[model samples]
Target: MLEQKGNLFILSGPSGVGKGTVLDALLKDYNDICYSISTTTREPRKGEVDGEDYFFASEDEFKSLVKKDEFLEWAKVHNNYYGTPKKYVDKTLEAGQDVILEIDIQGAKQVRDKFDGGIFIFLAPPSLKELESRINKRGTETKDAIATRLENANKELEEKKNYDYLVVNDQVEDAIKKIEAIIIAERCRL
Candidate 1:
C-alpha cells in the first residue's frame, strides 16, 4: 500500500455554534492528527497557556509577521488580531499528518482560496433563534458582544454554500459521525 499524503481540513462556523465542543470530542480519540494552533494578539484568557491555546504575541510582533507574509490567513476580530502560522501547518502536512484548522468564517474563506483542494466544512446551528439562545447561554460575552456575534453569524450562514460540506450541529454525536465520515471519505478520494 502507498503512504497517504496528508490533507488540510478547515472547520469554520459562527460563534456559539458548538464548533469547539465538537472538535474537542473528536480530538479526544483522534490525538494523532495535528491541530493548528493559531497566533493571536489578544491576551490569554483565564487558564489559557500562551503557546498551547495560542501563540500569544504583542501587536508589534504580530504586525511584523503580517509584514513578512508568514500567515496562511489572518484577520482582525473583536479588536484583536488572529492568524494561522504557515510553517507549522506546512510541516504537519509534509510529515503526512492531516492538519485541522478551526478558524472563523473569513479566515476559512482565505484558506480556501489559497488551498482550493483542501476540505472545507461549515458547521451550522439548527436555527438562528437557537444560535442566539446558545450565545446567550454561554454568558461569556457582554450584551453588545452577543449582538455583534449574532450579526456575524448571520453573515457566516450566508457563506455556507461555499463550503465542501455542511454539518448542522443539532446533536453532538451525529455531527461528529458526519464529520468523521467526511474525513474518511475525503481520504479515500486521493
Candidate 2:
C-alpha cells in the first residue's frame, strides 16, 4: 500500500454557519478522520468536560504555550485565546490519520502559511441574509454578537478564493457529500 499522506483539513466559516453541525456529522461517519482539539483560555461551558470539548487552560498556561511555540495556529477572539496543539496533530498525521481542524478563517490562514500542502475547505451560506438569520436563530449569541458575526461574515466570504474547496451548505446532506468527495479526491491525490 502507498504511504498515506497526512491531510490537515482546515474547515472554517462565519459563526452560526453550521460548521459545527457539518463537522459533527462528518465525525460520526468518517472513521479515518480525527477532530483537532484546540486549547482555549475560556472556561469550559456547562456539561463540557476538559480535554474533550477543549483543553481548557489558564491564561498563564496558554501564554506559556504560545511562548514555547507549541501551537500550529493560535488566535484571540473576544478576549479568549484558542489554539491547535501541534503535537497531537503531528502524531495523528504520522500515524496516517486524516486530521480535521475546524478553525476560524484567520487561524486557517495561519495554518496555510505554515503548512504547504494541507487542504482548505470553506463553508459558505447560500446568502448573507440567510446566514444572519441562522446566526440569530441559534439564540446563543446576543444581538450585538450576532451583528458582529454578520459583519465578520462579509469579510470571511471574501476569503473563498484562498481555500482549495468552497462548499455552500444550503442542504446538510448535500454538503456532507461534497465534503466526503473532497476527502476522497484528496486521498486519491496521494
Candidate 3:
C-alpha cells in the first residue's frame, strides 16, 4: 500500500576513535541495517579484504571514479582518498534498506549537504589521552604518524556540533547500546 524509504545514518569521527569496533558490534546485533562499504586509495591493512573491509583502489582509479561523479561523498584524508559510492547507497535505500556509512568527518560533511534528513552520529573518545593510548596500542603507526593523528583528532572534535548525536566510545558494548537506541528511536520517530 505504501512505499518504504530508508533513512541514511552516518557514523563519523576522528581516527582511533574505535568506529570500526563499535560498528562491528552494532552490526552483529542488528539484522536490518546495511553497512555501506567505502572505496579507498590507501593500501589494505593486514587481514583486510578487497571488497569487504574496503574497495581498495589506486589513486588513478579513485580519481577516475570521482571524475565520473560516482561517489556520494569523497574526501582526501591522511594522504589518501576515501569515498562512499553513490549508486550502491541510493539503490539500497530505494529498496527500503537502511544504510549506514562509517566515515571520517570530512566525508560526513559532504554527505550532509547531499542527503537531507540524514542522521549524523559522531563517535568520540573519552579523552585525548585515552585516544592516544588506543592508537599506541595498535602499533600500526610510527611516532610521527601518531602525533599527526592526535593533531587531527583535535580538529575533528571541534566538528562534533555538526552531528545530531554524539557517542563517546569508552567501551565497545556501551557504544553499541547507545547506537542501537538511536536506531530504535529514529525508527519510531513520526
Candidate 4:
C-alpha cells in the first residue's frame, strides 16, 4: 500500500507573539511533525546553523532559486529575501510525516492561495499592550523598528479573519494545547 500523505499546518502570527516558543514545545513532544526550514538571503546570526535555522543564500543564489520556482512562497521583508522551499516539504509529506510551516502573513497568504487543503492557524497576542511589552522585552529592535513592527502587526492581526483557527497566546501551555486539539480535530474530519 502507498503511504498516506501527511497534512500541512501553517502557523502564523505577529512578531513577539511567542509562536516560536510554542512551536518548539510542540515539536519537542511530537516526533511525527517536521518543521520546515526557510531559505534567506540575510546573513546568519550568531550560533545559527545552516540548513537548520535557515538556508542562508547569496543574492544570486536566491534569485536563481526564485527563477527555477523552487519556493512554495517567497517574500522580501526588511529588504531581505526569505522563502520556503517546496522540495523538502513535498518529500516529507510523501513519506507520511506531518509538516509545520512557521511563516509570516504574506507567505501564509501565498501558501493558502497555492495549496487549498492546508490548515492555517493565526496566533494572536493576549492584547496589544502585552504584545508591545513582549516586543520591548526582546531588546533587539530600535524604537523606530519596534514602532514599525507594531504598525505591521496591526495589519497582520486583521488577516486573522481569513484563517481557519485563531489562537490567543495568553499562556504558552494553553496555546499549545489549543493547537494540539485543532490538529486532532482536523485529523478526525472525513
lDDT, candidate 3, 54-171, per-residue tens = 9999999999999998997998888999899888889998998889998888888889887788999999999999999999999999999999999999999999999999999998
Where is the poorest 10-residue window by lDDT in model 3?
1-10
Q: Is candidate 1 or candidate 2 better by lDDT?
A: 2
lDDT of 2: 0.88
Model 2 residue 49 CA deviation in Å? 5.4
Give the count of colliding residue pairs in each prediction.
0, 0, 0, 0
Please give the lDDT score at residue 15 for candidate 1. Answer: 76
Best by TM-score: 2
TM-score of each: 0.86, 0.88, 0.85, 0.87
Residue 44 lDDT in model 2? 87
As for TM-score, the candidate ahead, 3 or 4, is 4
Question: Candidate 1 residues 1-190, lDDT tens each?
Answer: 7667788999889878998999998788667567898999998999999878899999999999999988989999889999999887888887788888888887888887766578899999999999999988888889999888899899889998888899999998988889888887888894
The reply for model 3, stretches above 4 Å from the true place, is 40-61, 76-81
- Writing each residue's lDDT as its tens digit, candidate 2 over 73-123 gives 999989999999998788889888889988888888888887778899999
Candidate 4: clashing pairs of residues: none
lDDT of 3: 0.91
lDDT string, candidate 4, 27-144, tens digits: 8876667899899999999999998989999989999999998988999988999999988788888888889998888889989887768999999999888999999999999999
Best by lDDT: 3
| Candidate 1 local lDDT, residue 114 | 67
Per-model C-alpha RMSD: 2.4, 2.2, 2.8, 2.3
